[model samples]
Target chain A: MLENFKFVLSHTTHPGNIGASARALKVMGLSQLALVNPSNFPSAQATERASRADDILASAQVFVTVEEAVADCRLVVGTSARTRTLPSQLVTPRELVELILQQPARVPVAILFGTENSGLTNDELHMCNYHVCIPTNPEYSSLNLASAVQLIAYELRLGFAQTPELPEQRILDNEQPISREQLSGLLEHFDEAMRKTGYLKQNHEKQIDIRMNRLFSKANLTHSEMNILRGFLRSVLYRCQ
Target chain B: MLENFKFVLSHTTHPGNIGASARALKVMGLSQLALVNPSNFPSAQATERASRADDILASAQVFVTVEEAVADCRLVVGTSARTRTLPSQLVTPRELVELILQQPARVPVAILFGTENSGLTNDELHMCNYHVCIPTNPEYSSLNLASAVQLIAYELRLGFAQTPELPEQRILDNEQPISREQLSGLLEHFDEAMRKTGYLKQNHEKQIDIRMNRLFSKANLTHSEMNILRGFLRSVLYRCQ
Candidate 1:
């Protein structure tokens, strides 16, 4: 289960956090990591902080956007400190592990973390199916970004108990939710179709797009269902033409 | 429960690790820290790495030996990475927490961590009533000292339920989500806009409406956000007319 998950750090300002995050993942037996728009990479400070876990950093994937970073992941989770007015499925680290165990189809999970100063942006948080909040001292909730990763990784290590055999064979491939990339395509199709019909205005496009993304994430559309939505949007666009 | 426990670092080499350990403890609501014969103290690097956890560092008690560092504690637990020839009451971090809870007499418990290079010397390990080990990747078990502190701190946080009440998180007034009545209005506005766009056919209108509702409900839009979406829809409708 740890093998199928990737930790994505978005807009990390400090090089040390990136390196420390790599070590955190490695120590917990997790290898996959993705970095989005880091302020600095390939820095000596990062290498030093990573200690002996250079391999993780060497193989780390970098993306310009969080969307691209987690495009292939079926389950997208965001780590947030604040309980937003518009919240996703909020879970503790332990609860998150239980949630993962309950569903074998939600493989290749992406656990997203935001920048050091401000956690996952509203737009970024909107993209996730669930929001994981590490309970901290409410008075002094100033948790470091890498420390946050360490706690989450530690929970993953403790909760799994030697990687129990998941019932993956029981869940059909088509039953799995569509990948983030596929979902993005479906959202784009809807945007184009709505635009052609004159329902989407310049100012409202972003809000509509975000809302659709949030909605579809909750819907957890599978590949076949995504195809159906795409077909419907294509017909609408054709009708407008 | 956390107030009754103190973390002691024996022979810590890196000052940065000391600072980070302070941060790790403070984040998990642990305040008492004792250092035994650290290579460097009152160092700038430690302060920098401690981030805002300098208060813990400031109040940290330093001693010449691990014996002195934990002399006041009733239950002394040492953290060890390796399984020594003569292990004493070996337990995982989780188990250590359980052990602490079982015996309330173990108040003012001291948990010891050893040097960065060579974890707790045999003499140091012999002094402890229990050895708490954090399980890491066997192939690469080079867990950072501060990270180890973080992991242990996290377990303590989870194992204890009556965490001392820190101040409650302050949620701004405007950040509160819009009422359900407002949500219904927003969904109606979206339906009107979609109908005007000709994207919502009679056959697909119901599906579109439900999807929009689901999306908005998840969005948990605030009053201002609701107005933004409503305004955008009104603009689209005006254009269509």
Candidate 2:
């Protein structure tokens, strides 16, 4: 699955970028880099820039055209540093992850970057299913070439990695999320406890009751948490009654 | 909230990256920039790279130490491009935004980046409450500095544009997240309770006790949750006899 994603740099001007792109891909666990019509290649600078990632540069395929580079890829995403005059389906780097995940099969996926002077040619961008624009300063959207590769590669890794976790919120051994029935029972129980305490007033009853619903939903009361809240609510109800 | 998020670059080698960073921050609608021991600043190279966003470079704050740069910040996040030998509370860049947004008030925030070549020192990383790792290829993770700023600043903007979403996990009631001082007190309470119960054994005591601190800290216990835990501990202490 990881191997399906390819980074294609079209019309790259600098040899260092090809090397750096190779490095960026390697660090993010992406190996496939296709460089199309690069101004320089097999230069000492590319190898020097690649540092330890010379293997990636050595393995990188050269293409005569963008179409040839992305030929077999099912989904292609282009990176645009600026908002184009021509509008297209644009996704943030994070959103691109979600889009990729929704793909039914592990088809060949390519993320394209343009040359240093100008971004992807109109034809190259037109080949893409979506454009992932890294948000940058509007006045000076001068994101360095290798830097763009890093950001896109980072997003790909983040997408492949599981969603960020809140460790404390995960249920412990033998604890479960509260079921819908339990949730209903909880809301009813809250109503009774609030009524007993005379906290649910005449005019404010609907608003207060709505807020209670929202709060409990937001709290994500696990079964154990529900039990604790119920125990506290029972204690309150008993005292008020 | 974006106004309070300061991008602190430490010992930056390139004036252009620093200048580019100012543009990155400004483009994301954040004005504050702080530099800690940059190699060169007030350079024409930075101003030239910053383009029209020189106002950001003009007003950027400089500090001799990371501590001074982040002294006023309630939240300090240090960016590390790779995993380090030293362990830290690592948060994904997206997660950092959520955590920042969850802050109860608008406190100054510092996001630190290390020099272009070496990245942040272990000491610098140690200063942060959370370390944000931008996923890179393990083989070649040479991310350019300013791009790091752009990605993080973009996250901050995304965080702010988002409709004040409370993760389903956060306790939604009146209970506030306890202060660090309160957390310290709670840790002490747990330690004392464990000692009284004869639960902390001799050889394992230090490791077990420290782990316990981490567990509760990660839990982000709400006021009521802390009260419940403390009450349980008190009950256990009462039964220690």
- RMSD (Cα, Å) for all candidates, in order, is 4.1, 10.3
DockQ, computed on Cα atoms, for candidate 2: 0.16
What tens digits encode model 1's per-residue C-alpha lDDT throughout B41-155?
9799999989899999999999998888888899988886556564688899988888888998878899899998889888988898988888888878888999888888888
Model 2, position B230: C-alpha lDDT score:
58
Deviation from truth (RMSD, Å), model 2: 10.3
| Among all candidates shown, the one with the greatest lDDT | 1
lDDT by residue for model 2 over A88-151, one digit each (tens)? 5898888988888898474799999998888988888788889999876565676667778877
* Native contact fraction, candidates in order: 0.34, 0.24
Evaluated on chain B only, what is the TM-score of candidate 1? 0.81
lDDT of each: 0.80, 0.71
TM-score of chain B of each: 0.81, 0.69
What does the lDDT read for residue A23 in candidate 1? 92
Residue by residue across A134-210, what tens digits does model 1's lDDT show? 87766677788988998888888877748767754665565557899998888888677667656675556776677
Where does candidate 1 stray beyond 4 Å?
A82-86, B161-241
